[model samples]
Target chain A: MKLIGYFRSGASYRVRIALNVKGIKVEHAFRHLRKGEQKSDDYLKINPQGLVPSLLLDDGTVLTQSIAIMEWLDETHPQPPLLPKDPVNRAKVRAFALAVSCDIHPVQNLGPLNKLAAFGIDQANVTRWAKEVNFDGLQACEALIAAEKGPFCFGDTPTMADICLVPQLVNARRFGADISGFKRILEAEAACLKLPAFADAVPEKQPDAE
Target chain B: MKLIGYFRSGASYRVRIALNVKGIKVEHAFRHLRKGEQKSDDYLKINPQGLVPSLLLDDGTVLTQSIAIMEWLDETHPQPPLLPKDPVNRAKVRAFALAVSCDIHPVQNLGPLNKLAAFGIDQANVTRWAKEVNFDGLQACEALIAAEKGPFCFGDTPTMADICLVPQLVNARRFGADISGFKRILEAEAACLKLPAFADAVPEKQPDAE
Candidate 1:
């Protein structure tokens, strides 16, 4: 398998953590997102969305979307499962993950941020936009997991929720989003970072890091 | 089971389709998103994300995120499956679904659009932002499924991909996106609308729709 990603992409960072958690090894490839390499024709052929963290199976099938790729890994390599066994619990874990991947990350990521800049919203407001979106989403995430007895997001082990939360927290810090009030989320993050799987998947540790 | 949703919310519409597909009957409730009802204290207790399409199970478990709720529904009631039996095919279907739910819908939805308006981007430009994001996303969605001989996104049946696409196409038309060129997507949309499951989930048909 060959995993195509960029070091700084939160989505790519997500798949890297999943791979590490499952102890799966694969060839690594990079797309320089800053240079718009993901939009190149060749990359588009592999992933029509031209997004990072596409997993290319040995049979030549390419899986796009970090959430889907992570689920696929969990299904194919079931040991150290990234989700809970019960149906409702699994739903809870997935809901937390999507809150980050869909609601929070999309608005704060490069595409929308750059679009905000293009609208003559100055750098200060653009930065503010990122921070506000991150802070709002992370607050909701904190509430979502408020009831769980978690060193992780759900339980003792890090589920997909932690896999997702860790990366978005990294982005939160990057945008200077004031996440200090999110005590539960910060606790989950601290717990996840203790493991090598999550630690090793940090953006700075990736081969493509600048 | 009771489903709390707003009629016009695309995410809410998604879970409705899944319920209709699986033949699961549930009590229905609404949170008027435009009136800021989703943010009301009571609603937030059910869903901290303050998003529509929250499913409240009989035992009082609140399942948030349309994708997770749909997956949970599928898992608990497997007949008339919303995903393929094979893992690879399941991943492809989910990837396509997330392409809409995460990438296209979030950026164009009420939250981001209202934020852009708050940035002093005029309504006309804000509308343009919606159109551009929707068109770009739908184009990628078309290309993503270009290889499959699909009436639905994956096969003869409407998978989660088709469930996601139907509502998004509604938003696209609302934004006046030039979707006339997406032949495959239009074809899939046509196929999906032929089924009552998809047809019944339309925004206008919902009880709470203005």
Candidate 2:
């Protein structure tokens, strides 16, 4: 398998963390997101949306959407499952992941941020917008983990929720958001960072690390 | 099962069509979004995120996120599968779905519109933003379907791709987008409209239909 991605992309970060967890290393291709490389013809051929973290299969099929790719990973490689076995628990896990990916991340993406910049919005305003929405997502997710006692977001097993949460939290911290209210998640993040898979896969460690 | 949603919510509309396709008659608990009812403590107890299309199970397990709910519906009711059997095809179908739900719909959501309003953006600017993004999504989706030779988004069947497509098309129209570039999707919407299941689930036809 091959993964095409930008190093600092939260969506790509999710994929890297998942791949590391699965112990599957791929031929990594870096697209320089800051240089407008995602919109290049070659990259657009890989993902028509010109988005990062498009997984190219050995047989040459490409997968987009970090959650969808993560689900495919869970389905095909089950030894260390990203989702829980129980359906209800699985729903909770999936809901948490989707809440991050769907409700939070998209609105604050680089594309939209660039659009904001196009309107003569200052860098501070752009950062503030991203931080504001992402902080809201983190808070909502923190509330979700409230019910389920966790070393991770769902339980201690490091399901898909953990894969999603770590990157989002990383994003929040990077943007200077106040993450003080989410105590349990802070604990979970510390635990997640201790693992070699996660630690080594941090965006700064990637070949294309910006 | 009970679904908490407004009739005109495109996200909720997707789940409603999925449930109808599976012949699952869950109770519909209306949350008048226009009236700010989703912000209530009762709804937040079920879904702290305060997003609509929250599905409450008989055992009291509530699921949020339209994609998660749709997948749960597919898993629980397997007769007419929303996803295809092949991994490649399934990835293709799901990418098509996320192109709207993840990338497009969230940006044009009511909250973001309200945010733009607060940013001193005029109604014309909000409408312009919504139409542009929604239409960009439609054209991308149209390319996906056109490549796959679709009566629906994938084939003749109304997969999750179509479930996402039709609702966003409705939003696009509501925002006065010029969807003329998406000839194939308009065709798909017409096809989706013909299904007794899809027809009955249309937002305007629902109990709280605006």
Candidate 3:
């Protein structure tokens, strides 16, 4: 499998963590978003959205959307299952993941930030927007895991929800947001950092890490 | 089962369609988004994200996130499956769905548009941003379905991809977008409209329809 990705993209980072957790071997193809390589014709053919983290399956199928890609990887390579076995529990895991991946990350993404710049919003306000939205998004996630007595969001094992939480909190910290208030989320991410697979998947550790 | 939703919220609309397609009966609880009801203590207790479309399961499992709710419904009651049978095919279908659900819709939702206003972006530029992003997103969808030769996005029957498409087109039309350029998508939505379940499930026909 060939994974086309960018280092700082939270979506790509989630996929990276999932691949590592599943112990799947994939060739990394970095498309630097800062360099505008994703807009190039060759890459557009791979993903029309011009987004990073397009996973090319061994059978030549391409999977886009980091949430969908993560789920696909979980289904195909099930050990250390990214989802809990029960369907209801599985949905809860996905809901937490989507709460971060869908509700938070997309709005603060590079394209939307650029759109803010286009709207003539000041740098202070843009950073404010990022921090505010990211915190609000994470707060909901923190509230979610408080349901189960969680060291990890679901339990002792790190599932797909943790994969999403760590990267989003990384984004949250970059803006100087106070994530220590989000107790469960902070604890879950802290648990993940102790694992080698999770540590190795961090953006700074990647070969093309910016 | 009961669904806490607001008419015209794309997320809420997605659950409406899924319930209809699955032939599941849901007691409707409408929260007026324009009235700020989603922020109420009652609603927030159900969905901490203050988002629309929380599905209260028969067993009292309150599921958030339209995709998660849809998938859970599919698993618990599988007659008319929203996903394809094979794993790879299901993954491909979900990848297409997420391309729209996660990639396109969330960033352009009513919440984000309000964020634009809070940033002092004029309504015109906000509309412009929505148009540009939606068009780029539609092109991505069009490019993918072009290979599948769709009357619907995937084939003859509607899938999760089509569920996502219809609401997005609703947003496009609400914004006065010139979507004739996206003939395939428009055609796919039309085919969806022909189904009783989809037609009855449209926002205009809902119990709380405006």
Return the top candidate by lDDT. 1
Give the per-residue Cα lDDT of candidate 2 at B88: 73
Instruction: Write candidate 3's Cα lDDT for A46-112 as tens digits.
Output: 8888998899988888888888887777777778799888989989998998898888998888888
Which pairs of residues clash in candidate 1, taking residues 3 or more apart in a chain or in different chains? none
Per-model C-alpha RMSD = 0.9, 1.3, 1.2
List each candidate's DockQ score. Answer: 0.91, 0.69, 0.80
**Pick by lDDT: 2 or 3, better one:** 3
If scored against the real structure, what TM-score would every candidate get?
0.99, 0.97, 0.98
Q: Worst ten-residue run, lDDT, model 1 chain B? A: B148-157
True contacts kept of 2: 0.53
List, residue by residue over B133-159, the lDDT tens digit for candidate 3.
Answer: 787788888887777867888888899
The TM-score, computed over Cα atoms with residue i paired to residue i, of candidate 3 is 0.98
Task: For each candidate in the order shown, give its overall lDDT on alpha carbons.
Answer: 0.92, 0.86, 0.86
> Which 10 consecutive residues of model 3 chain A have the lowest summed lDDT?
A69-78
DockQ (model 3, Cα): 0.80
Q: Model 2: per-residue lDDT, tens digit, B137-197?
A: 7776776667776678788888999999988988999998899868788888888999988
Docking class of 1: high
What order do you get sorting by lDDT, best first? Answer: 1, 3, 2
